[model samples]
Target: MDERQAINAGKAALITLAVICLGALGVLVWEYATTKEVTNTAAVAVLLVSGGLFWAFERMFGAEAPRSLLGRELPTGATAAERAERRRAYAVDALALAISGVVLGIGGFMLGDPDAFGSLGLPGGPVTGAVLGFVALFVISFSLSWLVGEADSRAVEKRLARLEAQV
Candidate 1:
């Protein structure tokens, strides 16, 4: 397909994925509200599907956009800087996803066992776990993002140097 057509297709696919995600989320919420019970199966399905969507999104539009998502190599058309930027964007997206997963996992655990935290003498129960999990997720995600960004920068610099030497 031509570039414009490919872009349009990608956009359509993204919208469809988003709608599917929303529908899944709605079902999850409805199930929880009606049952008044923590459903691990539904929650896990949502998380897994969401994570798959995130990965698909990154593969489709991040550093590999210039090439087909199924392609194994980076396209020659993308400059080092552009690739680096895309990599950084992917890192941020991944970090956000990690944080979300942590929160969701903790929330699920809390809902499944209300007294799990109370036995520890924590005043606010799951709130304390949520807070701690958030802090830990932030720290871990930030560190990982920084490392990925640094690696991307190094790769870009090396590519630029090689290009400069060839000229």
Candidate 2:
């Protein structure tokens, strides 16, 4: 396929995957609460409903840039300082998102089976793979945001500095 077609396909696939994931996650919570496994038909119905809701949400709150769907990084502001600041901001955001995802995923996993992790002789070891997978998901989203066009880097830098000073 051509580059454009490939990108489009990739975007669609990613969105669908995310939607299905949401449904599966719902199933997990449901199963945990009820202690009953979901049947194939119920699972499929839940998946469809959840996916539709997610799609609707996306449509209602569309991205500012269409290129973002195709993994285009945003442009930074002009001047060296502005560019540096933008890069730093992106890196910080990406790292924070990735770390948060992994941490939360591991926490949830442990909550579900605390002894399972401790028994492994390595705390967090049992859930490490799943945690990393969650982090990867966050990283993908961050990477796509990073691909958007450059912003007013100087403004961003000043705002970040102010926020840092406030903390």
Candidate 3:
């Protein structure tokens, strides 16, 4: 087969594998939900092997392979305007994450206190766990945003340098 046909075949195989992996995961969840325990070692193995295979195939086929499989195009660097838009998007994501962190923190604090009305009947731990969770989530969200922005900026710089050198 030609290159396009080969790519299509590879994508189809990946999709099939993904479906199987998802099915395995669903089965594990179902088993856990029904029995309160997961005894399916085989299914877990399937998921682990599938993950390894997926990683290996992506390496073999190049980065675009999975993106194409997901019907997404590789981002071809970004302009200043696009970068600004991304920053706005990241800011929104950070805000959402912060709100979620606050909710989780309150929930954790309430859960840790036996006097709380919504206590889930578990052994209570320190309320500091809640504060830690909130802080961790806040830090992680901003760190991720910063890392992505930095990577995008570096990619743009490289592309610009290449273009300038060629001119």
Candidate 4:
């Protein structure tokens, strides 16, 4: 296949794999909730839903997407080389997104802290803390995975472009 075709194929494969993983995750999450406590169910549900959402987002809006989708949004026009460069930048941007998720998680933990919330005049206690903790983990893990997948797609696209250029 050509450079663009190969990149698209890789993206499709990754999305398919993510969908399969989410299927298994759903089952496991259900079992975890039923076997454990009811309070823990929301955490698992959030984790699973967030993961699915992240994967779907990446599948729809990776390196290959913004080119076609955002071109109308920017009339400046982009050459093949510029598109390739954008792919690289998108890969780096994914990392920034992952870092943002981490930072948000840290802030969530602080805000959700029992003692900390008391000072804030909205203390909900451990249940609140645990729920927030689960949300943090879910958001962090899902965001990181989604970013990594997009970055991987960008790398694949860039590599394919280089190979095509060499040939």
In terms of TM-score, the best-performing candidate is 3
Model 2 weakest lDDT span, ten residues long = 61-70
* lDDT per residue as tens, model 1, 1-167: 75467557777777877777787777777888999865768655876787788667644533222222233333332477766655555455556765786667666675796643335566676767666666666667656655654554455455556658978
Candidate 2 residue-wise lDDT, 1-167, digit = tens = 65356447656765876878777777767876796665556676766776776655444332223222335544344677855655565666667667766666668666795543235455566566655555676678666545543423333445446658978
- Candidate 1 residues lying further than 4 Å off, grouped into runs, are 38-50, 64-135, 147-167
lDDT of 4 at 26: 70
Ranking by lDDT: 3, 1, 2, 4
Please estimate how well model 2 matches the true structure, expressed as its whole-model Cα lDDT. 0.57
Question: What's the candidate order when arranged by decreasing TM-score?
Answer: 3, 1, 2, 4
Top-lDDT candidate index: 3
TM-scores of the candidates are 0.42, 0.36, 0.52, 0.34
lDDT of 4 by residue, 20-115 (tens): 667666766677678763445555565667677656655543444232212322111246775556545544545455555555555665776434
| Model 2 regions more than 4 Å off | 1-76, 113-127, 134-138, 149-167
List ranges where model 4 is wrong by over 4 Å.
37-161
**Model 4 scores what on Cα lDDT?**
0.53
Question: 26 in model 2: Cα distance from truth in Å?
Answer: 15
